[model samples]
Target: MKKKNDHGVFAAVRMAAASHRLLTVGTVLCVAASVAVSLLPPLLLARVIDRLTAGLPLSFLAVLLYFGSLALEGVLTSAQESLLVLFGQRMTHALRSEMSRKLSRLPAGTLAEQNPGEVAARFSGDVDTVEALFTSGIISMAADACRIVSIMGVIAVKNTGLALILLLVLPLFAVFTRYVQKRMLAAQLDNRRAVAAVSGQVPETLHNIRTIRALGLEDYMERRYDRCIGDSYAAMERTNFYDAVYSPVVLLLNAVVVGIVMLLSASGNAQLLTLFGMSVGTSVAVINYISRIFAPIESLGMEIQTIQSAMAGVRRIDAFLDQPERTIPPARREAARGDVEFAHVTFGYGERHVLKDFSMTVKQGEQVTLVGRTGAGKSTVFKLLLGLYQPEAGTVTIGGVKVGDITDRERRTCIGCVEQHFSRVPGTVLEQITLGDPQITGEMAKDAAALAGIDAAIRALPEGYDTVCTEGIFSQGEWQLLSIARAAAADPAVLLLDEITANLDAETRPACWRLCAVPPRAARCSLSPIASMRILAAERSRSGAGNNI
Candidate 1:
């Protein structure tokens, strides 16, 4: 069942936060403690200035208080960083795990629907962006807010009139900042898509580099790559242009605030002067608080960009996680025997129907061979019998059990398939043959290998069954032999081969045919083509084996 696509960035964060509640709480507390401790030094400095203005000697207690607060703040800052890092790492790990699980659950066509490089970028780049949000962006923004609030409290206590003036100036800066933030969010999201596009293009070109070189399409590849690079550059340019304008605007606002403070300090109206009641020491404290307030504002600008970037990544991830997943339900009934049937099945690929009212049956312990011309729905029959694609009408059943109703465990245990091309995974020979199935031991693999007549060849390798597989080491014939061996390792009762020898040359065809005839006791081998049937019949006659087709 497909997940809903409505999941958003906020939902992703809430999910992460729910899972790591303790860590989230710990990080927030550390940030609060750190900000509170950091605010102490400025207050202490103001106290020292007031004492100096009173023409009194500085107390040892006052100096100790300032230095002690500095030391404590440093420790709290370290603790906060540690907590944030721990939280970020945990969240990233969970997200990566979730994506991996999602990939496994996704249907076969997801890779074709989405760019492989873009999917990979989601794993690394997008995940890192989200991690940075938790680690630095969110925590820093929170700490800055605490600092600003603490400073505002100081300003209010020092002089209400000045505090009121600062408040009036804040809204103008906020309005300008809100405008910039909206632009930045849109620009950053575009930049992220551009980066993903570039990432997708690079791997596509590299993976097919051989074909490009062979076809003499080097210039075309270069042009395509250049276009992707240009897109990324244009996106970054827009984001940078907005960022460039922000700094100057903030500096101008800061200059205006300084001018207002200076004018207030210089004024001599009796009521205003009485309202000020501010000594040189108080003026210094107020000016310091003003800088603190604007410092957070500056940080707020950058942090908003970081947050927007992360939100973009989150949205991508959410979309991925929300896509339809292929799920295997629990088996309703066990297979009593290796009997395959497709009754009046209708199937199609999009608008093109491959099969119409197709009916076929292969009884238990029988070798059923099907032969037809290309595009005659031959492969589609195998796909339906294997439950790879759901039929548009009618039903497919194996051993009295509906194919779709069978669990993956029962299906894997009952049937095996060798495609025209098998995916080669990196592993030792035995591991690759067993595909890491714990139930299939090395001895089982060897038995299957021997039955398939590939044991001698595998044993001749450098490490026998433990030899590592790499390109060029195994011949095409040997690879085909390994594919057969891997399929046989499951000891399945029903084996499906879909034009497996379609890609093989005459030199390797005989050996492949011989391997196909080796396992037939309590097992069924379904082969296609008249030549394959002839070869299997010839081998069966020579070995006194069971039915060939």
Candidate 2:
């Protein structure tokens, strides 16, 4: 199937903003009102100064108006910032939710290939950067841009020559801003990659600690980890360098512009006077406007830095969203039966073909054993039956229904698989058995445990079924039995045991074999070489005991 094109982060931002129209509109209004209110204070202060210089008494109303504008600007600015934070939060929530939904649609192979720690960084760190993009980057930059432009418009009226000078210098400042931001963005990207590596390394090291100790590779592992951290530190240093240089250069230009404006205003030449001419009140107001213009300009540098950093995160998130999704088959509501068939099935992982033109059939009520060495397609058969991957050729079916076409919920009830190891979740023993499935009742779980020969072991716990599961609560063999109980909880039609006894000791093997001998209520077919052998041995022992009796 063809993949859907990604619309990128801005599309998500727009959708989030659209959902909260009131917050979006409120933030914009606050920003505009703040910008408009900000201009009033400088004008009022200029008027008050001119009145004092002209030996005129200042009216109480005029003084009140000047202070009132200042207070109003402060209030509007505060409100705008608050609104921005709220808006950013909404965007973050929507973005994370979207990513989570995307995860379910991704191909199983795609998910298997991803590093858990790096994927987590995309969910947490990268998504947080997106929030910062809205609150402190894009929205903040827009407001600062408007403030600069508005202040320039006032200065243009007060002094045309000064406005012209600013216009010429602003573009150069913008070019420099873009240059520095690009460098910072490159550094940030490098830093994020290094951080992800460091995050992944921790889990990898913990998982392989035994092998590392056996091989005496502790020093080597430490050096490798140190190198990742060092890379991150170096990238940060580059970003800091650009950040430190940006503000000082902007301030220097601001001082130079102010100096030139002051000098020209005081010049004796008629042409310079005509262009830069200003009365005492106008001169004070123009200076204030110039200062205001540069303030936002300086702030723009910081905003741009934030934006550049966030852009790196945005690109990564977009890449994740763009990965091809698995093709979902049309939903089928009919219950799947137990007869299994594999016809002309060709499959491979990358370049190595595990099964080519293979065919098999296990009729209802039949138990079949498939014997194969490692890499001889033993586990591959289970994966194909479970529909984790699509076959290169032909079909695998359960009761004439293609396995790949089965929905996740139906597949669970269709086939019960007991893997070599058990996956523990954060919950009580009963929850572990049910795995949070609303369909499975407590009685169903208890029956599954009994079928797996672990019901007595669980009841012996402190709180029986409700006891919170923890490490050491159950031995390794018991954990495997719980896994079997979990699988059988749904009363599946077929049971696929993939080396369920591979990790069990001799003492646990007999119990597992005894449990397998007890036919499940719904299961009509059983497939596994190890399981078949144990079942036959158990049956032979029962027959021998009967004869002795």
Candidate 3:
């Protein structure tokens, strides 16, 4: 079943290549030209040797033709390789783009459950293997197969006895080649596993550096790392042993075949002589062909190894592309408004139900605070409101519209959430606030920053809002303040603050209250503890808004 899926992936790759007809046709032409051009050099060399044997002076044209064939073969071979690389790059680009699009369509649950390292490997490592599958695996194997068959056909025409010998010898060589490749592949996989273990240790050591130092476990860690390295070294040594043995065996076989052909050409029997007899030049060409054949045969073995190794990566990509995707609701134009309501809602992560038959409502212009101990489904409410997950029963609605049906663009303007931690993206300080939303203009960002009480600190920087942000540019508390500015920048109709003050000091805690003063006085606000309901009631009274707890 998995093999069938792999074949489907190959078919998809073929379709991707075919989409670029010009490149595909050019690559085919180059491969064909390279194979035809490769045969000429030895044949031309044979002619040159025959003239010398005849005591005939070689013409400049003959020398030019011989060397010229060699040069043409080199040029064609390079072109073929270059075209394959370009074609592979195009395929990789298309594949990655498709995967990226797939990510957007996948259920949020799928992404949340995925391992960051494994997901990264799909985009980076597995995608690279697919490229190798094209440039080094399949296409290279095809070219080598053509070269080998063409050489065999020539040998059959020129020397039947030698061709007969090759027919018997080649199959045995192929079987031996496959056996060696399989052994090498096993060693290579073991090496990769050991290497991955070694790679993982670096980050683990860094993350636990303080613990290691305090416990005096430095020597223990070093020994573990050393073991991983030793395992990798042993695996590589095994692979190297097979690699070192293969080439010499191939060359020895070439020499033996050449020797046998030479002996048979000088045999006493007329039949053997007729089958193997050749002019001095023909013998030279036949020997050169024998030597040439071994190279492609060796390449075929390696290409087989490459293809087999890449199949694992291909299967991973296939599974990713086949994951169940989220269903997109049709676009809605009406702005989200009115009371925020949760009616008989039930939700959970797998079998662990966080909220069951829960219901709540906060009217417009109302300030609501949910105060409870940890594991009380406070955070789950915000996730449901943000449409990260759909309720298993009933509905969560804003202004009579299902929250799950709200488009992402509308959600940004409709409901603002300040999470416990500020997620820093790669950009300037202003981008951190605006999040590159075109709708959040520069003026709006500045206003929200001022509202969150971070505008003064931002202007103090060398580049002000334009300063390229880096670590330590803002303290932990200031990053939280920046997150508030981000959430409020869109001037959302309702703000959901999920323990935003949990990480903030007393000095920074007051900045969160300014969100209540933002324009649109009717906008509702929901806050979850680390602030007690008593404090929220005080703020509500101070701001002259009805409070709900």
Candidate 4:
């Protein structure tokens, strides 16, 4: 789908600023006040020097004004920093929360198509870049701009000729700025991609650590990671090269202007020394102001580069937010009767159809086992049943009502699934079992674990249900058991198990079968449990063990 290119970096800034306008406005005011106060010290010092040269007594009040301005500038600077830091934190929190909400609403298919590393990079690195713009870069740039303007006004009033010479250099600086700004964002985006590759590699390597070690592939993995780092380093080097060139050029131009003023003053030329009363005191102040004025231009050049990085991040975030969301129209919330059917279903990934004219029916309360080869669409059947995917040419019905009649929320409440691969969630055993469901109690979790024949494994850990169980802590077979236990904890009317015992060893096979013995709830019939397997026996179906396909 075509997306609107509008609302990139500025929209993100507006979103953050909207939440804390008072704080944002206060920070800008402090920056402005600090810049205004800082110009005083240089002006006051010039006055004192002029009086000294005139053979007059130094005014104590002038010195007092200079010192007092310094103090006031320091206070304003501190307040600006403090306010920006607070705003940065608040903005980081709000943006991250918004990204999470957007991710949650996206379609399952869309999420599956995204790379984990890329998503993580956007979430952390991109979000941080935007935060930097808010917390330090934007405010500091504003202050530098104000300082430059105030110093420029003072310089122009003091001597128009000198101001004119200095002003000529600005157009060159503007051209240089435009050139650098154009290249920066593209380079930063490439750098972000390189960094994301690195981010994805680490977790992927960790997940396959056992395989890597078993095959002695450490050097191979290390070389791959080195490639990612090298690309990122090269991207950053290009950006820094622009920064290297811009700062020195501005400094060199400022120095040249200062040299002309000093030489003209020494030559005692009336045109150079007398205009706007450009005496020794005024010359000194002008030289100082040149540095002050040029300093902002240089810093601003760098800040503009940072702003580009933030803009790239905003574009990424906006693209993600624009992706299609899973939408379930309002539908009946009636409970499913546990009778499931797939009528003439046709589905596939892209053009390669996996299921063609498929039909199936399982009576309410009947435990059915679907047996098929790896490519025979058994898993696809379960996906269709669970509403994870829609068939192109058929209807799936649950409880005698079409799946279209059920809301996503209602479907989730009625069905639970245990798939072949288990996600390694970081949490205690109980937390893993309940999966953050507030309605499930510890006792209920333990009961679910017991039904899945995983309760003994849970109790073996030092903290039992409270024991932390992340990746690498559990064997593949044990992890599958935990997945089943989690599905059981949901206590849904229909339970779908797709090759749940595929990873189990011979020793764990018997224990896995006990998972089907979970006591049916009051509204659940005996036929609600459906298991897909790679092999099945006719005797098993006839013995009421499970209906085999």
Q: Identify the leading candidate in terms of TM-score.
A: 2
lDDT of 4 by residue, 397-496 (tens): 8867776567666665567777888876777989988877777789878887876667898888888889887666678888888887787675665677
Q: Tell me model 1's lDDT, rounded to 2 decimals.
A: 0.75
Quantify all predictions' global Cα lDDT against the true fold. 0.75, 0.83, 0.81, 0.75
Q: List the residue pairs that clash in candidate 3.
A: none
Give me the displacement of residue 290 in model 2, in angstroms. 2.0
Give lDDT for model 2: 0.83
Name the candidate, 1 or 4, with the larger lDDT value.
4
Report model 4's TM-score to 2 decimal places.
0.87
Give the TM-score of each candidate: 0.88, 0.91, 0.85, 0.87
Q: For candidate 3, write residues 382-464 as lDDT tens digits.
A: 88888888899989988888887888778788787788889999999999988999999999999888877789999999999
**Clashing pairs for predicted structure model 1, backbone only:** none
Which candidate model has the greater lDDT, 1 or 2? 2
**Model 1, span 371-410: residue lDDT tens:** 6667877777777766777888999877677777777776
Candidate order (lDDT): 2, 3, 4, 1
For candidate 1, report its TM-score: 0.88
